[model samples]
Target chain A: MRRLINRHPSRRMKILLGALPFILAVAIYAIAADARGADGPDKLMPGLNAITSAMSRLMFDIDRATGARLFWADTWASLARLGVGLGISAVIGLGLGVPVGFIPCLRALFEPFFAALSLIPPLAVLPILFILFGLGELSKTVLIVFGIAPFILRDVMLRVAEIPREQIVKAQTLGASSWQMILGLVLPQVFARLISSVRLSLGAAWLFVIAAEAITAEAGLGYRIFLVRRYLAMDVILPYVLWITLLAFAMDYALRQAHDAIPWTRFKEGG
Target chain B: MMAVIRLDNVSKSYGETVVLENVSLTIEDNEFLAVVGPSGAGKTTLLRMLLSQEAPSSGRILIDDAPIAAEPMPDRGVVFQRYSVLPHRTVIRNVMTGPEWLAAPFTGRVMGRARAALKSRARNMLDRVGLGDHATLYPAQLSGGQQQRLAIAQALMMNPKVLLLDEPFGALDPATRRAMHRLVLGLWAEHKMTVVMITHDLSEAFHLGTRVVAVEKRRHDPHAPHRYGSVITTDFDAKPRLARQIARAPA
Candidate 1:
């Protein structure tokens, strides 16, 4: 941040430049919302008051149907589903990727299949997942895992493959078994790439989960957005969109920090 | 008399593209054997075969009068022209990897007495290679010469019976190369391990090798230069300092 500020004209200028676009966006949104509201009180653009009221209502008001804070319920449900889905993806990606990249036998076995799999649009298989796994949490999680696992796997494989052959030879001469070579040499080196891949695929993971939830679900952020769409509740939708963005941003930032902290990865300083 | 390592009519090819053809060599224990040849003359291929990283298409490589195994063993240490050290590991850790990995097949952890013994051993090797002060630093932190030195130390840590060097000093500056030459000679004298070095530098081969072999393509037709692959063309004894040392020893 210090370097960033110094490279700009001044710290104050940097801060102003950073905030200007966002402030401009907010002002434009407010004006548009107000103008539409003025022309039609039932306009689709919900003014600040409408968003504030919706947020408060969503935060505090207990649903008569379930006696739960619907916003929190939706957030929790989506979070839990995504957590499990992405967890499975990381495991499959890291587990299969390193071996396939390092060993020619495994590469021949799995690489072509994954290469073909990655090409197939994940959304095209959504209906199949629902049919196979059935329309439950299982199907939703499966959709997300299917959506991002291939991407993560490919990223990890490429990273592992990029490790110089000389290093592999050196490891072999050091008396490392194939397993030990993978564990000690490849695993730690590919970790930062795995983190980067996970972050990259997070967007697609969210897309699949939200699409799955929108089609069918009892309680989720996506379900809530799609549910309120019938009522044209832009006030609820906008804040929810912002909340999701904020969550995704936080996750990306956290992954980036972890990537920076690793000294051996190509992302690290002097690397 | 049993030869420590032997190559019997070894031939290697990638489909039609032959690299090495019908090469026979015998390596006695404690001999410093150097191979010199032009690029594409199969010097690297020969070293790769001995490391068991590549297989000869025909004939065989034998160690201790038995056919060599498919996998590379810690009994043989190799230093490549480049990327011999894993950049992620610190110098000490890089040297210690052999012992730690060997221990893992049994203990799964190099701990208690084993870890201490390995550390001391690694430190000793590091000191021998003049990297005692930089043990905790990563390979990236070291200069190219220093990194190569560290690699040499790492290779020596397993007490390998055969030390194979593939132009290990090729990347160093001239002065550094000379220093490395002296260092390698000292290490060879102290350890008495059988060494096989593949080099393009004729001087390095002569300076270190007890025996030097030239791998050259025997052109069947002058018009068709690429028709034949590399075979042992010249096999001769080098300046034998080891012989002098043996003669001077009080028997």
Candidate 2:
């Protein structure tokens, strides 16, 4: 299996594989267009036409709108919410999870609570959140943080716990302190796993943010989606969904690249 | 020279299982001592007790005439049989971690001075291990011998007076193991550090250890049984020859 991946395909083969999906999509679109003549695109999907049109119109708006456009504004707002949420989660997760993971007693005491909390979806507690914080970015951001923190925390904790006891013993013999064991020895190895966990939890947090914003947001991409949905503007809804997905994709890609490009790649092989 | 470590009438057990019994040994400063035995012969258990990573159920362990109460001292360093090198750090970073941990916190001057000193010290040690060129490489990128060198470098980072090695080359192939043996000896001779190593390979113990101690099952009297018989330390010239000689010895 490794040999297969290592065997580099030629440029021509690469191009063919890269173009296959687009070629298929275009072929399908063309055939549908030809099948339905006058209102071919619409006729291709009678019920879904409004969705397609609404999406196209929203795309048009996003492209044409100039200063302080809602699209860009919502994008930035959603990104800000995600950033705050992910950052809070990262800090809190690592800070608490590492110690819990290192100490077995703490793990026994706290892991169950975290596990129980994680099982309850953050979205399910939206009413309580709305009652407390109302329809604001605070509620939505908090929702994202809650959604991701437990999952990320649990993963980081497990990774930390899995650090070989031998390594800890070695560090102890070397006269490393508790913090040194964590930062110099434990954290370095756990960082990669933690980063991966963050990435995984980021996707969950994004999903939760959208759900949260849909219910309690005055602004954000989810709010935009909600506003468009009120009038059955499928065009706007589709584009909003696309934007959210694109944002998630971009963030995830950026994270992976940053992780890969780190100079510490010299020390560690895999997360 | 005074004995850096002393274990007197030391006995250890896990629940009902007795691991080591009535074990007494003195490791002098600058001595390279190797404890060798068959698998589960309590050689590792003795090393663990000496390292202060584990406590004997009964008896006392002293380091520099002081009781080893908690973890081993800053003056003591250890290399494990595997993964002694932190995989996520650079080679130099792994070596420097010891000093950096010991340095003052939250001050630029302290950190800066420590960093410079660590860099120079780590480089010198890495060069000694013949790994100067691979300072930036991860342990995974290095060969078994090279990773062992990195592990050795990490142990030496603090200029420890005592270095504990637990089967350092146990996992290496014969050729790499032989090369590592030479490397360790050279390091020991240069550093003149006290080394207490555990090995299953009798030959390795004889070659590297100034005084090789053998741990093996002994006949128990059942009436007043001791878990371990007397550990016999031989001045084996070479580890491999020691293995052959032990094999020839009567049971």
Candidate 3:
């Protein structure tokens, strides 16, 4: 028999091992909920049935006030804000980062400033953004952009700088002009890297969006989660948290797929 | 033979450190000039000077009796030991890049019939380099030898008057290096381009060069190593021997 440290699980065993903790947690929750008793006025831990029923209502039923399915509406609103904010950030990152990385003058002028800017805690600026843009969707969107754009920009600049000097020299020999080098040579490589940067920053982006929404918003996952907290609505809150986790996971998985699809990013330099 | 490239007492120094000092040489048209030296002997610096990627601190480098351009241009193409080909582009796209940039300077791409023509030409060049079947494959997908072949095809696409190679086979295995030697000799003969290749291998220098030149420090100061820079120490005419060998082998 192999030592415990040396033992490697087979595929089926790996899956079973992976699932053990989740099953144990659910069983523990069920046992705890039973101990607390099913009939209760102020139960801290909601039963599985209670959470499921709450989720079904959120999924299938229409809200009396808005006459809209609240969960999807919140998801749509959150996704829209995330998409717009990330799209603008990508454009800015590509536009500024490429030139900053490629041109020595620009790099000298802006690199330190941008590096300083990236260090500023983006959450610290939320109130300022609110004061400037007001408590509308713009403030939340701006918060997401402000939070992640600098990170993406820095990643892109580093990536552009990391492009082997030989390729640049080779391009120059091939008669590529400055603009042609940026557009044809640097841009494609930088753009592929931008997707990866965005994927990494998605967590931070989500945090900012949620924080902004929690502070002030009529709709969104964060708003819903925060709004029901006063009543100790653990059932809705638990499911909503799970849903957010699921969404974040799906996004990360999708971006990984997209990054892999490029076919060249997997290989290291000099390939 | 008329001289295609002439370096007139060229000296390159970075502040207190000198890399090459008072180096003078002339390369005739369609000549294969192989440069060999130990590391830090400025062999690559010499090749870079010819390619116009570096400037001489004192003297002038002339191409066809005119001063070479400050920057590398389509007139000279280069292949380095690594990262010569763009990793993101497919093999065919890499070959077409030079022509495309030449035709459409701003866009870096040609359209319709022009693009088709460039593609066909690129295909032919790839076939010449034995990479025709791997047109759509990215550089990362290629082996080292195949990538070098792609790089050669890419350089040849420009129809450069002078081709600069900086240890192009330095990273390859022995068998692959031999195969590349044959390919490069065939291309040099067929294209009739003035070639300046830098190598560490003396045998390779003799095998591929019409003229094999060694760059080394003529005088050394142990206390101040940077004081004395490398110069062309030995210049040998290998053309006659090469011709005789070719005659015997008939390959």
User: Which candidate gets the maximum lDDT versus the true structure?
Assistant: 3
- Against the reference, the lDDT scores of all candidates come to 0.87, 0.75, 0.90
Where is the poorest 10-residue window by lDDT in model 3 chain A? A34-43
Provide per-model DockQ scores: 0.45, 0.41, 0.71
Show model 1 residue runs off by greater than 4 Å. Answer: A1-16, A40-42, A100-104, A266-271, B1-3, B106-108, B220-225, B241-243, B246-251
lDDT of 2 by residue, A101-140 (tens): 8877888899899889889878888778778987787777
**Lowest-lDDT window of 10 residues in candidate 2 chain B?**
B104-113
Task: Kindly give the stretch of ten consecutive residues in candidate 1 chain B with the minimal lDDT sum.
Answer: B239-248
The TM-scores of chain A alone, one per candidate, are 0.93, 0.81, 0.94
Error of model 3, residue A156, in angstroms: 0.4
The total of clashing pairs for model 2 equals 8
Docking class of 3: medium
Q: Which residue ranges in model 3 land beyond 4 Å of their true spot?
A: A1-7, A38-42, A266-271, B1-3, B240-251
Q: Candidate 1, residues B129-216: lDDT per residue as tens digits?
A: 9999998888878877898898889988878888999889888899999999999988987777889999999988998888999999
